[model samples]
Target chain A: MARNSSLVFEGRQTQLKPLFPEDVTQEYVSWLKDPGVNEFLEARFKKHTLATQRAYVRGFDQKTKFLWGIFDKKTKKHIGVITLYDIHPMHKYANYGYLIGNKKYWGTGAAQEAIALVFDFAFLKLRIRSISTGAYAPNVASVFNYKKMGLSYQGTFKERLLYKGAFVDQVWYGITRDEWLSRRKKLAF
Target chain B: MSTEERIKSIMADSLEVDRTLIKDNASIYTIAQWDSLQHLRLVMALQEEFGMRFGDREIPDLVSFAAIQEAITKKMKSHGKE
Candidate 1:
């Protein structure tokens, strides 16, 4: 496929395409199993295998839950995954989640760009009203990315997640379509 | 200010540490406040102060004060600012 034609959503540094069962690879399974990579993700709690990943890829409904693989535009390397799930059409809302499986891409703006592309798709194309997400308090990177993208802190579930033999808070964040639109405008200017 | 000093100053301000504590070799692993989030903030500050943008490829390598300074210098030179 042509470079630009293949991308469902293209950002400056990252391109996102719908994930398929064929896209599942041993690397993807390894990312799920890597303790350091999944330190803050719920997936870390479970053992992942190629069969499970293939099944997970086939499980998305496409409407209520959409998954996309993030790729580096320059390298054309699949580095991560992003999903918009738990969609409520009547309420025009959904939940967002993402993981940068490639350690090399961490701390780069790939996560932020991939997220911005997803927000554009959610609010503009799907007409989603609000998008919600959360992160473990100790996962400072996730929390900071959400906040930087203009998601407002909703609340915290105190001692909701157990990590390293102790409890940690889960911080919730939400952004309405209006808020995202305005934020996009500000960023453009 | 020199590029090194300016880089240290931005790192100090972004991470909320004393400028003196921001050594050339200081990095996220070495500085308590220079966590992942603060690292992004520091990157943004450097971009704004130096009037240059860093490609995503450059971000991961820009972990330490010296690395940031070197990157900025190279970018500035490429832009013919140096």
Candidate 2:
């Protein structure tokens, strides 16, 4: 398979490439429908169709939001998706999210590398001051990975998300440009 | 405890399983309780126990008991311990 030449950023283990409409396959739709994959995601609350995914991909714009497919460099397979959304040029900040839809890649640090690449883009190229995100408190992997990536805890909304029959806290996290710069040298590329 | 035993104990504690179930070769696939979330907790526990921070590149290779043992050994050696 040919490498997606439109890769916007490269990391140690994964690359971030533009998510084109054609990249929305049945497999992608299936991932969204997979309860195991979507349980921690808001996407689990809704059904996803290929048509809807295609339209979502087609709606990507760099101004307000940027979506990218997380591709494994060694296997050259698209494993997940990452996005820097709610970008505000005036505020110089954004909120981000990521999903490693492939279970095989979970806990493998692929998400961490993808997150580092996004931070590089947000802080270096786009000159974003602060990048914020949130994770359900019960999602241990998301919480651990976000903290490991140097995102400081901002606050939490009590019983913000109804998950698995109980309401869970939604914890917010963010990292500023200065924070990223100070820690970038130690982080794996 | 030896490095292997230490790793097994950490894994068992993190996954809330009996320590006897975590053999030298036990891995994420082999252990029912060692799911993805537990894996991160295992990593965090290992880090706290060893006082060593694992790089992102090193985290993926630590799925199995032997791998964790080897990684901890290497890290300990680098820190002039063991």
Best by DockQ: 2
lDDT of each: 0.81, 0.81
Could you tell me the interface RMSD of model 2? 10.4
lDDT, model 2, position A36: 91
Relative to the unseen true structure, what is the C-alpha lDDT of residue A41 in candidate 1, on a scale of 0 to 100?
87
Clashing residue pairs in candidate 1, if any? none
A-chain TM-score of every model = 0.93, 0.93
Task: Quote the lDDT for A83 in model 1.
Answer: 96
Q: Chain A TM-score, candidate 1? A: 0.93
DockQ, candidate 2, comes to 0.10
